[model samples]
Target chain A: MVNLGSIWQNLLASQAPLQSMTGNATTMAGLATYSLPQLPYAYNALEPYISAQIMELHHSKHHQTYVTNLNNALKVHVAAIASSDIPAQIAQQPAIKFNGGGHINHSLFWKNLAPAETPETNYSKAAPSLAAEIEKTWGSFDEFKKAFSAALLGIQGSGWGWLVKESTAEKGRLRIITTKDQDPVVGGEVPVFGVDMWEHAYYLQYLNGKAAYVENIWKVINWKTAEERFQGSREDAFADLKALL
Target chain B: MERDISDSRNQSANSLTLSLSLDKQAVTMSASLFRATPVARSALRAASAVKPAATFVRGKATLPDLQYDYGALEPYISSKIMELHHSKHHQTYVNGLNSALTTIAEAESKGDFTKAASVAPLLNFHGGGHLNHTLFWENLAPASREGGGSPDGALGKAITTEFGSFESFVKQMNAALAGIQGSGWAWLAKDKAANGKLALITRANQDPVTGNYVPLLGIDAWEHAYYLQYENRKAEYFEAIWNVINWKTVAKRFEA
Candidate 1:
């Protein structure tokens, strides 16, 4: 079974970057998700963090494909579910749920995976404010990884690796969380971060080595973006935390 | 296997139980140092049946009003971050979901499966978006009115009983959340199925837990939630969010 220290050490591991997001169709205002979050570095920037070839396909083909499929999937959802026929309506769920979550989560996941070491970039060097927050919680960044990576490596199949907020009796401090399939965090569970470990997500990048992929996820992490998430949810996160013992 | 989209039309009731994360906080419950549990250990499941009437919020999911101001979560969350998450990303989900719904409505009205099949994915994408954002607002609170804090009384006692201590539970849960392989969710649910009536569970996709458990609290482990703050070190982000949990809400939820 997983122990506290081992988990703690892994949690203390390095940080992550941003995920890429693209979209289709337009809005009433007519935007195609124009500002889809981009990678902090070049496709090859992740190199050892994530192979270049894998990065290429992941960003261009895989993620982009999700966007395409997501658009296509919704088109299908329309025709099937509208039927008064029970059978036809029920059949459309897998596509709607799976592809839908894939599209949304992947877009965010891409924004989360940034390529570090981009010299001369203004947002490099994991935001100090965020690091301070990390330091306050886990004692040290290393300790956080020990806990985070241990969790990241324990996946079974096509699913995501997540870092979510926890609830306490006091609601004082939030804890990390992981969800299966497209399961969601409820009760004001602020989503600070997540990683996709589905084979399709990384089989191409690191082959069957999910561990390697999970570990390297830090090298190109986008702390600045995370800082924004933390700062965004801070009031609620701690407001709840302060309520707890 | 064909699944039921009937559930899709129904919106989960706004029964967000705020208070202690309770059973889930079994220690190392320290902030900024959360961990993930492997998805292999738990299957995605749903809360015990407390079925409510079907809710059909047609059109698009709208931007919800925050319980507090955008910057109310300062220190834990930044104003800039809040602005973007709610107004930008979350809104996108609402718009995208509505667009999908409209398309589906037209296709089905025309009795065209081929056309319906074409836009099916958007339903998931936008629907998931609508669902996630709605839940996000329900579980949070303003720091002043018993939102962020620690557990006490019954909530505290329960956490102590299950995970030994709050610290242990937190570590384990953090491990569980960090352990997720992809974008999904981690939760602290009360499993009424068993005698104890509570257990911590995690689900991978946008699939809601469909078993005998009820959600007390959930964390969005998707990167967008924290990539702006913690980067790849998800554990740190997990740990840091603790300072802003809005526990008063959690406690009241548990009592309900």
Candidate 2:
């Protein structure tokens, strides 16, 4: 339950400094113009498993639109912030979210993939900590993949399947979660690796067989990126918990 | 703070016979404050399937009449979107909920708990969809009418207090909305236990905001809500919707 009266009293008590503060600087200042990040490899790089044409369109067209839209929305958002117009700000949210999410997910997706020749089964060596956590949680790498793939296939629409570090609530565990429609994994969960399940991601290549796309994606999985994200998330979680102590 | 559930339920039952009949042009209802009680609750009362307006009241769920013309929210929310959303999308949910409830009611009557348990998801999804959309409709008005301005009176004061300012509140809600990972809704709900302090919360898919709080305003995040008018420029759609926010209706709900 929310105690609005007490909360209002608190706001009034702090109103002096709040009143003194200038136009919503945080909202307006230093807005990042998110650009289309370059794919680490050539369009044809993750071939056989993920086709060149798919990568080209997904990255160049789909991802680019998100970038352009997010930047455009932020301009209005900055003004909404300064004016203190609540409804105006609220109105801009959906655009920022969808486009921002597209940008974030695609950016992460591109980095987390590599050439097919890259070793697919080197999680234990590349990301020892993540591998140990996965092994402890799911018994082994094979079980973890099976679980992850099942979660991915279960998504009902255009979305991403993620392996995230649950750093809050459940704490320091690897969990498989699916977000429909480019919604980023939020609330203290740091994404280690993500698989795009949008039909546009594989329709041209895999046709209706989403499972085949999920299975084949492993051939181009970038374990090194996953390891770094895993290690960083764990460190961040530790710092957050330590602050409580 | 306890609601007179019986009185409210009775009121809903009394209104169960009323149904909207639209012309080919889709002009049928007018925005009036007397439709004070949540139509979502009134919708549930019609689930009895014994109502005179039984065409829509299938086993006890019915389509709510819009208080404004479908074209009333035009330029902000197109008449086409409102028509499709209300007549098709929301109606589908009402039908789904009624069907699910009918199934559950039958199972319960025959002591078939297993069958009842199996259809619970349908109830949660469709029932929640009906409830949320019902609230969604009541929370808007035509800008030319009594809509699109900031809140006033106690609701206004509460907004200022809890959120620092109205702009801050919208900003915070926007941040929350931006973070929902899928098809969902962003809500400005009142927390009864917390002295009516407002809270911003979200629900995934068709899940309703349940327990501890009453939803005062809900912004639908589902693509169907904006995909037609705004397309991928969801920000434009979201920003434009404020022109039709029914703050008076919101204040009334809060005071009750």
Best-fitting candidate, measured by lDDT?
2
For DockQ, the strongest prediction is 2
Model 1 bad stretches (over 4 Å) = A1-245, B1-11, B15-60, B113-121, B142-145
Worst 10 residues of 2 chain A by lDDT: A1-10
DockQ of each: 0.05, 0.11
- Best by the TM-score measure: 2
Clashes of each: 216, 11
Model 2, A1-245: lDDT tens digits are 11212211212323233442344445345554656776778999988899898888788877888778877876676677577765675676667667766776787788778887665436666778888989999999899999999989766446899998887645368889998786665556878889998766876676555689999988888888888788785444223212211
DockQ, model 2, C-alpha based: 0.11
